[model samples]
Target: MTTQIDRLTTSGWSTCEPIAALVRSRGLPAITREYLLAEFSPETWERAEDATHALAKHFAGARFADEVEYGVLLVPDPHFLDTRRALPTELRGGDVVDERLPAGVALPATRPWQLVVSVIGSYGPSLGSYNEVTASDDFVVLGQDTRQWMTRQVWGARVLQCGATPPDCEHNERWTFTLFPGEELVDGQAESGTVLKGKVRFRLGKPNRGIGSARVAPALLIDVQ
Candidate 1:
C-alpha cells in the first residue's frame, strides 16, 4: 500500500518534468537546472515555475544566471504542526517561531509578482538556545554580507541564559532578509536586470542538536520590471 508520505514524496519528485521543461524553454544552465531538481522541495519548484511564467514578459531575452537578479526567501511552512512529526527528517524544521498565533495561518492567496521563489521547510521550534540562518553565493547572490543583510530576533517571552540552563532548552528565534536589483541604462532609459544566485544555511541550538532540518532551493530569479 502506498502511504500518504510515500505519495507526497513521489508527487514532489514528479515535478522534475516541469522543471526540465522550464530549463529548456529558458535556456538556463544544465548544471543549475539539475541542482534545482536535486535540492529543492516540490513546493519551491512550483513557486519557481509560477514566478518564471509571471515574469516572462519582463525578463524576455535575458539569460537566467547572466542577466536576471534572483531572490529567494526561506519561509516556514504554516501547517507544520500537523505534519512535522510525519515529515521526512529533511523536511522537518520550517515552523513559525511565534507560538502565540493560532494554527492554520493560510499561505498568501495571491502570488506576489516581485517574489522569485519562497523556499518552504521546517525552520522552527524557535525556542532553541542558538539559531542562525545564512545565505551566500554558492546558490544565490546576496546583495550584502550574510551578517549585515540577515535579520535575527528572539521571539518568545522566556529567556534562558547560555550555560545557565541545559543546552537542549528551547528559545524562539526569527530570521529575515531582503534582496534588490541593480539598474543600468537601457537605450538611454533605466533598466533593471543584474545577474545573481542564491543559497541558504541554517543552524539551530547546538551543533546537530535541533529537531528540524532544511534544504537550499535552486537559484531563484526575481523579476524587477
Candidate 2:
C-alpha cells in the first residue's frame, strides 16, 4: 500500500496480466493506467489497435467485433438544421408555424440551445412492448408499444425531466434524465449508421413547472465537435 508517484510505472509495457501485476503493485501508472483506464481486453486490443481505423471510419456501418454492436448512436448536429444554430425564437424566419412546415421557405427557429442531443451507442434493443388488460368495467388496460425504438432518421430523445415531471429533477431524483436533442432525425427503425454530434454539458437545477427548462444533468458528453 505504498506506490503513488502519480502512477505510470509498469516498467515499459509488457503485460502478463495479473491486472498488469496489480497495477504494478499499486504504484499505479501501469501501462499508462491501463490505457488511461479503458482497461482493454481481447488481450488488451493491441492497446488500442491504432483506434480501429479511426473508430471504423467514425462508426460507418458500425457493429464491430470486440464491441460496438448497436452502440455509439448520438444524433442532433445536422449542422443544427443550418439556421445559424439559434433556432426556436418560435422558429425564427422560416415560420410556417408547425404545419410540419415545408410550404414556402423560412426555417430557423429551434433554439433552446438547439435543444441538445446524443447517444454514442445503443440504437438497438428498444423496439417496444408492454401490456396489461382487465377491462369490461374492472378497468386496467395498459397496452404500450408505440414503436419509436431508435434509429429511424435518428431523432426522439425526450426525457424532458423524469417520470414525466412533477417536482422531480434532483438530477432526476438520482435516476437522472435529460436528452433534448429533437426536432428531426427519425428514420432509425434499425439499419443505418453514422450519428455523431457532440458538445454536451449538464448539471442542471433551476427551472421548474413539470420540468420545461434548465435541467440537463444525466450525461456529460463534452465538446465532441
Candidate 3:
C-alpha cells in the first residue's frame, strides 16, 4: 500500500540515490555513508535532510571551517538536500478514488527531485580562490552546460538504462568541481572575492544498492543555494 507521499518520495529517492552517494563521499570526515546505512523513515530522513542543509550553510559562507572530533558529524546545507515531486504513472484502468484525495487536488504527472550533500572545512584555506565545492557523489552536479550534461549523463544513461543494456560509458560517473579563479598557490597572490557563489557544479553518482532501485529525478539548476 504505497501512500501518495510514499510513492512520491520513494521514486525521487531512487533517482537521487546513485548521484547522492558519490557527492556525499567528498566530505572531510564523510557522512553520506552513515545516512545511507541508517533506517529509512520519514522522521529519520527529515533529520538527516535538515542536518545536510545546516552543514551546507555552515560551510557555504566565506570562512574557515573544520569537523567535530567525535560522533557522527551532522551538518545542514540545502545544497546537500535534494527533494522534488514524482512523475505520474499509467493508470491501470481502475483506480482507487478515496477520501485521501483532497477535493480538486490535481496530481501532476511528475514532481521535482533533488540530490544534495554538505561538507565542513571543504571551503577553507586549501579551497583557495575561485571557490571549491567539495561534495558527495550522492549529490547531482547542477550547472554550466546544464542541459547537455543532463541529456547524456543523467536522463539518457543514468536514468533510462532499461536493464537490458549496460550503463553508458558516461553513466554513473563521478563529479568534478571546477575552480573558477583557480587556487592561489601563493599566500598573497590573488584577488579578494567570494570564491563560492550560491552554488557549484560537477558530475553525479549513485547510492548503495540496499535501497530501492529506480531512476529519473527532478532537474535542479543552481537551486542548491
Give TM per candidate: 0.19, 0.17, 0.20
lDDT of candidate 3 vs native?
A: 0.24
Worst 10 residues of 2 by lDDT: 127-136
In order, what lDDT does every prediction score?
0.24, 0.23, 0.24
Report the Cα lDDT for candidate 2.
0.23
The C-alpha stretches of model 1 lying farther than 4 A from their native spots are 1-96, 99-112, 118-137, 141-212
Clashes of each: 17, 31, 45
State the lDDT of candidate 1 residue by residue for 25-107, as single tens digits.
Answer: 43433323344445455665565555534333333332221222222332222222121112223232232222222222122
Off by over 4 Å in 3: 1-39, 62-126, 129-225
Error at 94, model 3, angstroms: 46
Q: lDDT tens digits, residues 1-225, model 3?
A: 122223222332223444334334423222233333332345544544454444344333322233211011121222332111111122111222222211211112121222222221112112322222222222232222211112212321122112211121122232112121212222332111111122111222222211111111212222221
Residue-level error in angstroms, candidate 3, position 17: 13
- The alpha-carbon deviation from the true structure for residue 51 of candidate 2, after best TM-score superposition, in angstroms, is 32
Position 111, candidate 2: lDDT:
24
